[model samples]
Target: MIDSHNHTSFSEDCKIPLNEMIESAISKGIKHYTITDHLDLDYQDKRFTFSLDHQARREAIFKAQAFYKPKINIYYGLECGVQPHIIKEAEAVIQKEQFDFVIASMHTTHKKDLYTQAFYHGLKPLEAYKAYINEFAWCCEVMNEFSVVGHLDIVKRYDLSLNEVNLEDVKDEICQLLKIIIEKGKGIEINTSGFNDIFQHAFPHPTILKWYKELGGSIITLGSDAHFPEKIAQHYEEALNQIESCGFENITVFKHMKPFEIPISDVRASLKLDIL
Candidate 1:
């Protein structure tokens, strides 16, 4: 199976060593996946840059690929935390690093860390959710570099009870965002992180996936969004089932910054046979 988004020691919030993550993927029978560490440039927190030493990170990936070759295919990728003010800095990193995949995501809105409770302090639940969706749309409209937009509805991760919010309330903005992604040949990932949380849904939600497919957006990727060895490819079979239910017959994978496809039937069969 293909798990296109993941993390390791390269990301500040995660501490698993590079080789350990690779071993974990092998254990899960995930032959194809990306080591997409975080690169949240110009982050509000001064202490946590989420940036990596490009040369060192690349060397580690190369060594792992050589050691694990034929057994596993490790693709080097990056998860860029994008914001309005830091677009240029994000672009510079993309230009410098030749990643197999680039996942643009918004971890904060209005320079406020979404993970912190402070981000939702003043606004009502729906208002807070709307603000995040708006900020994500703005980034999608402006930023031109990236293979896919990661976790398009990540705000739901923090707000476990966002029942007050409705997709129709932000339908225009959401549709525009999806259009831009498809127009630019970019895709979206179905992050399985939420399955481990109380929310029990993919990051973008299955309804959102249906909307994207209805709008003719064909490129969809699957990721466990795993931050640790144990979490690697977590709940992936269910996530793929969710995607298939959304009318996607195939999932996109990346290599050398180019796109490829794998039939969902094969992936699903792998899950049923416990061969992946």
Candidate 2:
């Protein structure tokens, strides 16, 4: 199986060394993996703010590649924060670097939009939810070069008490975003981190995946979004089952923006530790 989305110390939120993370994935029988470290330009939370030094990261990735390749395919990648204002800068960096893959994510609504109580203090629950979805749609329209859009409904990560957030209300907007993503030829990541959380399902929800499939969206990737070694390929079996149930026969992997497909049956077999 291929883990297309992941993080390491290169990302501010994760402090584990890259080698350790890679080794853990290897132990989990992941044949290929990508280190998609985070890069957000202007985050509201200063504590979770750190920009990737592309040069330094690239060097570290290369070093890891020398050690990990042949045993496992190590992809050097980045998870870039896509916001309306910083899209240009993000694009420039993507153009300059020959990354194996790029994941566009909407981590913040704006420079000041942190996931704090204060950020959602005044707005009604519905308004706040709409605002978040709107920003997500905007990000999708602005980011054209990403290989996959990570976690279509990631705002829920911050809103653990989202009793009022209705997928039905945002379905049309989310479908619109999916259309744009399909038009751009970028895949959507089935982030398994959601399975470990309160939602108990992957991002965008199963219904969203069904919609994407009905809309003729074909490209999809799977990720654990693992920050620690143990979480590598977490819930992969369930993730594959979810994709198959959504009518997906294949899942995609990337190498410098080019896609390769793996049959769901083969994925299931591999994930079962059945490979000879």
Candidate 3:
């Protein structure tokens, strides 16, 4: 199986060394792994800076690829924390770096980090959802240097109570965003992080995946979004099942920013995993 999104010590939020994370993926039988560490430029949290050591990260990735050789295929990637205002800043980074894959993620709105409660302060659940989805759509529209949208509905992750936020109420907003993504020729990743959270689903619920497919957004990638060793390629069986159920027969991977498709059956066969 291919794990398209992951973080290592290069990311501000993760301290695990790249080699450890790589060994974990290798142990899990992942044939292709991409190291997409966080590069959230101008992150709101003053306490932390999400800037990446690009050269250092690339060297480590190359070292891992060479060492694991024949055993695993490692690709150097970046997950930029995109916002409408930092379009040029984000693009500049992409242009300067020789990355294999780039994922545009919206971790903040108006420079406020989403993981903090301040982002969800006073607004009602639906209002927050609309605002978050709209901001993400705007980012995808204005930004030109990304391979796919990472965890499109990641705002839902913060709504752990699960009672306040309702994605159905904001379907139109999501549909419009999906159209923007497809129109831009970009894709979305089925971020499986939610499965380990309160959502019990992927970052974007299955319904969103179905809508994406219906809207002709065919570039779908699967990522565990793992930070630690145990999390690599986690819940892939359910992720694949969700993709198949959503009318996606194939999943996408990237190399030098170009996408390639692998049939879902082949991906399933690669891991010898099946849905129960």
Number of the top-ranking candidate, with lDDT as the measure: 3
* Model 3: lDDT to the true structure: 0.86
Displacement of residue 121 (Cα, Å) in model 3 is: 1.3
Clashing pairs for model 1 are: none
lDDT of 2 by residue, 1-276 (tens): 788888998888898999999998888788779899998877667766669888988999999899887888998888888778888888888889988899988777744454665456667666666677688778778777789888877676776644357778877777888888888888899999988877768886888899999998999988889999888888887788788899999989898889999888877887877345
TM match of model 3 to true structure: 0.95
Tens digits of lDDT, candidate 3, 6-54: 9998998888999899888888888879999998888887887888878
Sort all candidates by TM-score, best to worst: 3, 1, 2
- The clash numbers for all candidates, in the given order, read 0, 0, 0
Clashes of 3: 0
Error of 1 at 63 (Å): 1.3
Candidate 2 C-alpha error for residue 166, in Å: 2.7
Kindly list the per-residue Cα lDDT of model 1 for residues 1-276, writing each as its tens digit: 778889988889998898888888888878787989999988876667888888999999999999999998999999999999999888888878878999999888888887764577788877887787778878877887788999888876676556457778767767888888888888999888978877657878888888899989999888989888888778877788788888889988999889999999887776666652
Select the stronger candidate by lDDT from 1 and 3: 3
Q: What's the lDDT for residue 171 in model 3?
A: 87
